[model samples]
Target: MNRQTLLGYVYAATGAALFSTKAIFIKLAYMERVDAPLMLALRMATSLPFFLGAVIWVVWKAKRDGKPLPPRRLWISAILAGCLGYYLSSLLDFEGLIYITAQLERLVLYTYPVMVLVIGWMFFGGRITWMSVLGSAVTYAGLLLVFLKALPEGGHDVVIGTVLVLGCALTFAIYQLLAKKFITVMGSLLFTGVALSASAVACIIHYIVVSGGVDFSASHRFYWLAFGCGIFATVLPSFLVNAGLSRVTAQSNAMISSISPIVTISLAVAVLGESFTIFDAIGSAMVIAGIAIFAVADQKRAPAKRETLPVEIEAA
Candidate 1:
């Protein structure tokens, strides 16, 4: 593989691995008596500084080079991206985890690539290849296996959690679809930075309005855990994924991101004392194999091209 392609894989893999820890961190924070809202607020608050600095540096560099700023409308689009990706999706995911195992949550969230594929096909005139369909079938079948295995123990909570997680996956898919356009205009770092900062603001506002105000009286250990989520799980992975997206097609990156659930499940077993069954192993294997097949299948989809009008400039 060329250097950029290889680096794209590396970045996507690393970002996925890091993102897997988000559930673990949120679960850990809960174990320390930190509610999801409080944990999210603190995590986003801690992450804001780094993203803000990135925005400043990029803007300053653009000015120094005598480049004109992007259209002001792009900033509004960035805020909307944050609302879809960071704020709403994460809110649903975190709240869902209150009633579900980390393993099941990861499995449900991994359904997003299928969502992306289908949504793109249905709404954007993208073609749906048989290989993609087969891959999605295999992936969902595996998830069903895992879910059925866990269902006997989880009862009603499982149903509620699944619905919430499905919402999370849907919103996340929407964000990814939009981002494929936004990133081309605003650039990844600037787009990511602006989106992150906007999400941070939205999070802070939501926390205050919902919880009355921020509470800073948590224990030091909880503080450390929250910081870990902000830095390791949030900031680092966001940049890596953006970088990967810049270098590779979203299809390739989606395949590379299959590593995330695998890592999360393994870590859940090791660290959180979650059960690991034969179903887990088989299901995980199926999901990975499906992603592999999908990646290869996408390579054959290059020739059915059709002429299309340019995207509207207002998309910026």
Candidate 2:
């Protein structure tokens, strides 16, 4: 690989590694009796200052360099995207984790790429080729295998947890689509900052209402771990993924990301002492294969295209 491609792989790998810690931290906080809302609220709130400061610095530097800020409309999209993508998805994800194992949760949530394809075809007028359909079917089949394996051991509550986590996945898919739309106009730094800020505010409000107040006095270690989640998992991974996109095709990125479930499963077994059965391994393989097929099919059906329309035509 060339220097750029190597950098892309590094960035993508970094993002995946950072993201792998998410379930670990969530499980950790849960062990501390920190409820989902409280944990998510704290994570967002703690990360806010850094995000805001970064936004200010980024905006200032842009202005100093005579770059134009995104219009008011893009800011509105950013806020909505942040609310739906970060706040709603995270709330559901954390709650679902209470009922499901981290490995299972990641498996269900990893269905977002398939969700993205469906959403794109349905809403954005994107075409769905035969390969896309076949890929999606295989992907869901793998998901079904994973779900079946989990069900016999998970009891009735697993069904509810699965639905909630799937909801989180859907919401995140919407967030990705919306972010793709606005990222160019708003610029990644400013856009991510604003979205994260909005999410943090909403989470804080929800935390207050749910808990009757905020208190981190019980354990500073958990709070610090939450901060680490924000920095390592959220912030750093996000930066790396964006940086990686400059060097690699989305297809390549998707292929590399298919390894995330395996990483999560292994980590769960190692760190959380969760059992890893043969079925778990088989299910994980199926899921990764499904995603790889989907991505490959997607690339074949719809190679990336450059827009010929003027900026105004493209603007919403």
What does candidate 2's lDDT look like per residue over 1-316, in tens digits?
A: 7998899888877777677778877887778784788778777877788778868998899899998888888888888888888889888888888988888888888888889788987898878777777777777787787778888888877898889889998888878776876876777677777888888899889988887776645477678777777776676776677677667777777777776787888888898998887877777777778788888887787676421110100000
Question: What TM-score does model 2 achieve against the real structure?
Answer: 0.92
Candidate 1, run of 10 with poorest lDDT? 307-316
C-alpha lDDT (0 to 100) for residue 276 of candidate 1: 91
Clashing pairs in 1: none
Model 2 — which ten-residue stretch has the worst lDDT?
307-316
| Winner by TM-score | 2
Q: What TM-score goes with each of the models?
A: 0.90, 0.92
| Root-mean-square deviation of Cα positions for candidate 2 versus the true structure, in angstroms | 4.5
lDDT of 1 by residue, 212-295 (tens): 866556878888988998888888887777677667776667667778888999889898999999998898888777766776
